[model samples]
Target chain A: MAMIDSTRRSFVTRIGGGAGAMALLTVVPHPASAETIDLPERESAILEAAFGSSVLTPGKISLDMPILAETGLSVPVTFKVDSPMTEADHVTRIMGFAPGNPEPVLADYQIGPRAGLAEVSTRIRLARTGFVYAAAKLSDGTLWGTKFSIIVTLGACVEDIFDLDWQRDAERRAMRAEARAAAAAE
Target chain B: MATIRISIPETAAKDEIVEIRTLISHPMDNGYNVDARGQRIPRHILHTFIVTYNGVEVFHANLHPAQSTNPYMVFHTVAVETGTLEFTWLDDDGSVFSDTRTITVQ
Candidate 1:
């Protein structure tokens, strides 16, 4: 009985290896691990959560960003979706996600057929050096996306006050003062 | 109530893609910060931004609390004809701020 059990185990191992190799050849589910777009595992997971069961294709998105950001406080980004804004077809919404930030979702925009064009430009804060993913949902339930990596020289969103420099600390204080002044003015 | 400022070129050639910039004066209170007494601050932020040209929507954004105090946004739109470009910002307190600029096509 022991000898027969050993033989069955070996047979099953051989068959499993063959099927695994075949499955790898046909499967490309996770582009996050691809060679060109080496998206971090956490970011990939965030993307999956942001758009569940929806396959994100790298198209229809024109992402304008820099390769290096001097500071993580404010980085300008522009995203445009190439779509025919007709009554029949148009972009319904666009969303920006930052995996490294405390809040994975940075921004969400809703558009409609009334929108003659689909585009947005704004500055976003990055917690660290990472990639930004922008996805656009079409009227037909299709989601298109694009991503870009940015290297941050000075990181933002550091909670520990002791970790910040004099200049940065001063800046934070000034920003707070400005916010208060604005509130008072209103 | 809030005040808004918009910047758009006064003139552009036909089919020209013109840039639009908007700035609003409001503290985007994220509600994450605590006061001196350690009481949590309630979040009050601009919820949406919309731009319309010639009575048609062109761009829109649903802002989040992470945005800065005074929100600034810049976008682009094709100058197909001469018309009014309107910018509207909606706040959490059921207030809306709007500004407009006219564009001429050469």
Candidate 2:
């Protein structure tokens, strides 16, 4: 009992002494390890809307993304789909999606017969550290894709640019709106 | 406003795959930040890119706000003959920037 009491007291003291640590928590409290790797709801919906009744297989795509991106401002990504650029069999389009961004669909590329190539490389910004997906549409109406995760240190999608004052104001506005709605309901 | 640059092999063997690279200059505003006076800055970016080889459509892309300033792209294609490659980038402001290069296939 004494040992447990001592441990609890020490934990409290540690928590109280480290406001800087608390600030860090305000950003991403959950470490990357704690964050499960799963397809986000938005991403799943996008895929469903795109493929409709067709099946989306997970192969024939190569996604090149950095494991760790220091800046969310610009991260390079390259996508390649294995296809013969012939008349009957060719890649029609390649689309990029980021589930965590303010907008999920990042970019779309239309591959025509003249391109003769099925690979594309571009730089994209990220809102937060999250998974990036690339999907390729074939002429035969088949869809193939691949996804990879990236860690961003500095975020780019700044709805309020991390201003605490602005955040407080926004929160207050939201609360007032909620209260008004509840009163109206009553 | 933006300028485009493209790189391709000067010569290639028939049916050989050639790499194409391109770059553009522009500020891709994410439309989320406020200016110095705390006013939100409007977003601007190059939204579309299209590549044509010898009057045939080959590669095209639609960009978004997530793209950084001075966008760069690299792609691959097979060489068939000596032809002109036209690269065009459309801006959000309805402006178009274009460049052309010739690839000689031996």
Candidate 3:
């Protein structure tokens, strides 16, 4: 009975030590890698530049877009923030980002107290199927945001053709100019 | 020359919220496409848009290449007194396009 009790005690100690090591492993690398792994570096940098150290709480902003877009050339996006629109408390700025686009920044809007509503609708181009994010900054220095995933069938900004010779471009331009001049003379 | 269009109600009540829609014609070339001859097309896009109401800036937008061609935007503002709303678009090539509309507030 004494030997059995000692074995049980030793096993419990080993299990506790193993659990502690596992917890340490998870805790040590989590915060450093989580942010980098969650978002692309460019997007994270842009958001950091815009919002500073403020945390982007995921609420109070409603971003609406089609779940599946027929094409990435023009996707209609609309966003509204729950704000009083008063001078003291209003949405000061709103920014949109498309992760898959060559240039991630879609648009940045600056709103003033005179804006009766904190809402905007615009068309944006997407390079491929990816996540679209919208973030809003309030007068109180807090930031709120939301993201929507969109599937694009036809992509944009990825055209492949071979007519990039500078000499050819200049010649084409001159020909067009001469044509225009001729038309003007006529 | 770009075609600029502004749509706003001619009149509104005091403190009434009115929607303002604006559209501009431009090829917001994102500088990513190569021509048929394999030449990259230079980027040319309208980078900024601003709306000034009653001599005060109310709404402004910073656009990028991700904005579609013929950028169209709709936003809301309060109608306070009678004033002119000036819409301006600033292009990457340093061209500025502007249009103005007057709104009467009762």
Candidate 4:
């Protein structure tokens, strides 16, 4: 987690009143013990009730986050996996989890042979330090994943009563990414 | 707590990959903020997540405390034979919350 400075607040206020609040839809499921986040344990129960016991293995996933975020409200994030994409070796799903939250369930991506490769990258918010895991389903009808811990000291999405700009920053970031990629290829 | 919802496009053509978007509500405590007592609270978080289609587990990510509460993640998947896509959430207590979305792959 990172701390907020007065300048950042003013920056957000000047922009608008929409801090990627809608973006909350894509979460990374983490554990409560990883940070001060208190979440109901039933989230997983809900998961099991819907999907039966699917085997999840270890050492086949990766999470890219900061050891110490410069700001808690917005952190750069990227997730990737090394799985075969053939019809026989293709992956079916990809899930992201962060432990220390009121609800640990994050974003879930349904992937297949069309995903190009077993790779994905996006921005996410971090509230604390704990283990982050990536779980994937292989064409063999089995589950596999990987996990890592990040230590920090601040909340990422919080702000003053009338603060915004997370969305703008995200948009700016997307453009910059595109520009940089084009520059790199050039 | 916020309800996490997941949905797959019903228009997904058979064998066409569709994008999945999911959101869960949880407070990500980075062990930085202090309460009225100024006590450094302990860590609590989601361990890992697993998504499956028909009966096969597919995608997943390991979450850390540093991730913001109610973290929202987006990923991609393919609709092979037109079946329900089951999305599940796994917690530290070994608990799980899941939902199934029907995919009408043309």
TM-score between candidate 4 and the true structure? 0.47
lDDT of 4: 0.56
Model 1 segments beyond 4 Å from truth?
A: A1-53, A67-71, A82-92, A111-119, A138-141, A151-156, A160-186, B1-3, B34-40
Model 1 residue pairs with clashes: none
Q: Which 10 consecutive positions of candidate 3 chain A have the poorest summed lDDT?
A: A21-30
**lDDT tens digits, residues B1-106, model 3?**
9998888999999999998988999999888876774456899999999999978999999999989999999899999989899999999999999999999998
lDDT of 3 by residue, A131-183 (tens): 88788899999887777777888887655222335477567757867887899
* Consecutive 10-residue window with the lowest summed lDDT within model 4 chain A: A20-29
Cα-based lDDT at residue A182, candidate 3: 100
Proportion of true contacts reproduced by candidate 2: 0.78
> Count of backbone clashes for each model?
0, 1, 9, 106
Q: What is the lDDT of candidate 1?
A: 0.68
Q: Which regions of candidate 2 are displaced past 4 Å?
A: A1-41, A44-55, A159-186
A9-122 per-residue lDDT for model 4 (tens digits): 345534644243321112233343443222235534533432343334554555555545555465555555667687778766666666554345454556666554666654
In CAPRI terms, model 3 is classed as: acceptable
> Which structure among the candidates has the greatest lDDT?
3
* CA lDDT, candidate 4, residue B62: 60
Higher-scoring candidate on lDDT, 1 or 2: 2
lDDT-superior candidate, 2 or 3: 3
Candidate fnat values, all:
0.39, 0.78, 0.94, 0.20
Residues B1-106, candidate 2, lDDT per residue (tens digit)? 4666777898999878888888888887778765664456798888888888897777777888878789888887778788988888888888889989998888
Cα lDDT, all candidates? 0.68, 0.72, 0.79, 0.56
